[model samples]
Target: MSARVAVLGLGAMGLPMATALARIFDVVAFDIAAERVALAVEAGATGVGTVVEACLGTDVVVVGVRDGAQLDALVLGDGGVADSLPTGAVVVVTSTVGEAAVRAVAEALAARGIRCVDAPVSGGPVRAGTGDLLIMVGADDEALAAARPVLDALSSSLTVVGGIGAGQQLKTVNQLLCGIHTAAASEALALAHRLGLDLDACIEVLSQGAAASFMFADRGPRIAAQLRGETPPLRSRLDVIGKDMGIVGDLARQLKVATPVAAAAEQLYRTVAAAGLDASDDSVVATMLAKEPAW
Candidate 1:
């Protein structure tokens, strides 16, 4: 029989993932917001208005919500999916919540006879749309095997990291590096403009040279747009980066690791949020840097 899958929280990432899974499996898409569910339904997914209804008959349930609190509400609260899921159904948590929260959820689900996997993803919305995203999976061999089809639908690269919470651990490292690299890209481009170098030429040369990164290439044009007072369409928002970086900070503290660079980037994102650009694309950090005197 074909696996019945439910994808919850139909946001930018979740909606595309659900659409991709629907192409290969029988999918029930659920979102708290009616409009998002409606949109997914229009895109050929079976939309369910409630989380309970979505999980009732699914073989695998993917929770793509924002953070730990939202995850808790969907899985443990009144009318939650945890109470409604079939005994052997697997719960795939694709949110980038920290290690502690994921582990706790896994334990809770285990008590109720449901398998939980921490399967946080990366590669941004563009990759998500193309089904070429990377999934960092944290589950045992059996759980990994059980979720392989769903993972195949969402990712071109899937790594089965050790055990419960390992995926979130790796994702914390991902956010730390991404936050720092994004800040570094802004600083580099802003410095080039101040030095009277042709900004586009500088980027063209340097991005082809040893200093290039995914962040520099992807955020460069958006940064340039923000400098011209035209914001690019949001792929990842400043607030989302800030939240992920905050999780990194929390993880670093728990592990007693010093993360000065990540902390600095966190401050920049905090400033971006305070400037009321939280809802803007993350590349707007370049605008914040451009406002400084050319020195």
Candidate 2:
């Protein structure tokens, strides 16, 4: 029999992973939002009412919550699923929380002999639904062995970074680059618009040259369209990146890493959030960028 799996949290990223895992396992999904649960059920997985209900007797639990505080509450706080998991069951935390936070959660689960992996992921929701995610994992060999099926089901590119907390550590660096690239891409496109250039042609040329970046290819067109007042597909949310970049900042401060580019990018995300685009897609950063320069 396939490993019985439960996917806790069915938001944008979580829902897609849940649906993809459902194709190969006995997957049950849970979330606070009724609409989200409804969507998961429609996608072929059973939806459960509570986290406890979702994890009861499961072999593995895949967590895809929003941030550290929420992940803490879900795994260690009241009604937390960690307390409910059977010994030997693995918990895979795919949230991009800090290494420190993931270590704390892993240590707690180890006390119960319930293995945990700090596995942060990249690629957006579409890649998640297709099991094409880029997954970075941190776990011992045994725990990794136990979690392999679930990991394989959700990733096209997978690497075991190190033990216990290394995955989140790498993820912090990953977000550092992501934030810088996103901020820079938005600024460049916004500048092009200010110059009255052919937006589509500009994007095409930039993508073909050394100036191109993954963020430019992935978010550039959406940013262009969003500037024209079109609502693009929700691949990533600003509030999510706002939260991720905040983790990156905290890590940088703790380790005394100078991050001028990332700090500047973080500030742009802050300004965008203040303008009420947090719930919108990250491409909405272009809206804030396309305004008159203060200088």
lDDT of every predicted structure (CA atoms): 0.86, 0.89
Alpha-carbon RMSD to native, per candidate: 2.0, 1.5
Q: State, as a TM-score between 0 and 1, how close model 1 is to the true structure.
A: 0.93
| Clash pairs, model 1 backbone | none
Q: Which ten residues in a row have the lowest lDDT in candidate 2?
A: 286-295
Provide the TM-score for each candidate, comma-separated: 0.93, 0.96
Write down the TM-score for model 2. Answer: 0.96
lDDT of 1: 0.86
Per residue, candidate 2 scores C-alpha lDDT tens digits across 75-177 of: 9987787788999999999989888888999988899889998899998788999999999999999999999989999999999989988999888899999
> Where does candidate 2 stray beyond 4 Å?
293-295
Tens-digit per-residue lDDT, 74-140, candidate 1: 8888888789898888999999888888888888888889999899999877787678889999998
